[model samples]
Target: MARVLIVDDDKNIREFIRLVLEEEGYATVESTDGRDALRKIKEHPCDIAVVDVMMPYMDGISLTKEIRDIYNIPIIILTARGQIEDKELAYTAGTDDYLVKPFEAKELIFRIKALLRRYGTGEEEAPVRLGNVLLYQQNYSIKIGSKTVKLPLKEFELLYLLGKNPERVFTREQLIEDIWGLDFEGDNRTVDVHIKRLRERFRQLSVPARIHTVRGVGYSLEVDE
Candidate 1:
């Protein structure tokens, strides 16, 4: 499991982010401020760091610069500031990504996965096998028995994420961020539409894996036994 360092002065926010990351299988370390966060990172390096802006001892932008100067770890700034100038400052400070306050839990997870993949640090996701069907990550193609079929980009990535985790359930909100992105203005029904199309395509190809909906919750990929 990847380790994530969470830096925030607000205990509730820290805990909330921690819960979200922990639920997604990431180990978390928490700090109350940027000064403390720096010390923690030096003592226990993490794969990624989620820093909050407007903290006491040291602000997130300053911390981001310090971290960049010494470590190659990816950084994501979580703040209530949505101003363009604030975002520009974060990018200038070497932040890999930024998330505004009141963000979706799924969006956070999606960004972390994206950053890991972008930096080539999270390559542990394996190809999915379901009876006669195979979901290839590298080529972004699906194989059904002897035939190889290429799916649309979003569909392929969505299917791969679900298939890679097998029985793990993913909420519609999670799907939206993982596929449409956090900036997407669409509703959750968009996920349903994609899943419907994915199912239809799988049916046409006679693929054995099916996406199962968890009522009022999310969806999961189920492989036939």
Candidate 2:
């Protein structure tokens, strides 16, 4: 199932969209504003975002630009404004589609499916950077300067999650949930073993980023410089 982030200030609207998305078999996450949406996306990756234009603190246009800067996910603007000027602004912010409020639920679903097809959710995003180490999402590989090497599934997932949100300390519990899933029956020490393996491998490869233990906390991926 493709995960979607819904960003809207109106409670009714957000709930309505959530219902529609969930009924269609797409998993949904909600945020009241762009700031919350940003934080949510960092914690849980989403395939696309449905962003409302008029929001507190950060508007949809601004949020769209920010998302474009960091993520390769598609963005759809949901707004009450039907003005061509507003539509243009949304496009300029890198939104893939725009839908005005009072739209038919079926139309919204169709547009979403079209965009997903065009972008192909199965495709892995562009390589993400952590210091000089380039983490490739598609092939479970990492590049250090001119050298590239494939990583084991668990190791790549662990490293990718940390690298995607640099400096954010992930406790052992969060690591297991995010990378290993709720059904994980192993001890938290599993995380430590993976971290040690990552450190050793990066050292051997001279990768510019390393996973750093956070004392009482868990760990984080940081640039070596």
Candidate 3:
């Protein structure tokens, strides 16, 4: 499930949003104001933040700018005003989307899902970038600088899965189900062999990206640089 942070000073509004979001199977963290939201975001690292304007401290636009400076998570600015000026300010502050007050539950859920897909958060597939490595599905290849290599079918799919959700561990069983068919019989060794091949390929590309093993758990992709 995707995680969301809801920031609002009104207890009723916060609870309402939390209920709606939880009903849709989303994990939510609630905050009373911008400062609290910032703390929650830093500690918990949510996938998206739904912020209310005109709060006690920092305000929504300011909080958006601050979050943009640090984390790359998507932000949705919520406000009571319908003024274009407020929308422009929110967008200028780096909010990915904007929603007015009294929004319908379905609209809010739709916007959240759209933003998640656009940002490649959770399990959604999209083109991913880490340092100089670019994985694009349009061309079905990995592009490093001017050289683009179309990997073999399995290799490409495996690399794409790892790249799609960077820093998120996927156990061997999860990887097998995601990349290969669930009916395909495979052991942990299969994932190991594919990971080995990906490592060698990236080593040849000379990029900052690397796949890390989580001992007895699984594997995650990390970029150092």
What Cα-based lDDT does every candidate model obtain? Answer: 0.88, 0.87, 0.85
**lDDT tens digits, residue span 126-220, model 1:** 66887878887656788876789888878888988888888999999888877888798989998898899999987888778899999999999
lDDT of 3: 0.85
| Candidate 3 lDDT tens digits, 91-203 | 99999888888777766886787678668785544668878878875445888889888887678778877887889999988887666644457687898999999999888
Error of 2 at 46 (Å): 0.1
Candidate 3: Cα lDDT at 221: 89
Model 1 worst lDDT run, 10 consecutive residues: 118-127
C-alpha TM-score for every candidate: 0.71, 0.54, 0.56
Model 2 residue 129 distance off true place after TM-score fit, in angstroms: 43
What is the overall TM-score of model 2 with all chains considered together?
A: 0.54
Residue lDDT tens for model 2, 59-173: 9999999999999988999989888999999999999998888887776776676567567884346788877778886677888778889999889889888888888899999
lDDT of 3 at 64: 89
Using TM-score, rank the candidates from best to worst: 1, 3, 2
Better candidate number, 1 or 3, judged by TM-score: 1
Model 2 global lDDT (CA atoms, 0 to 1)? 0.87
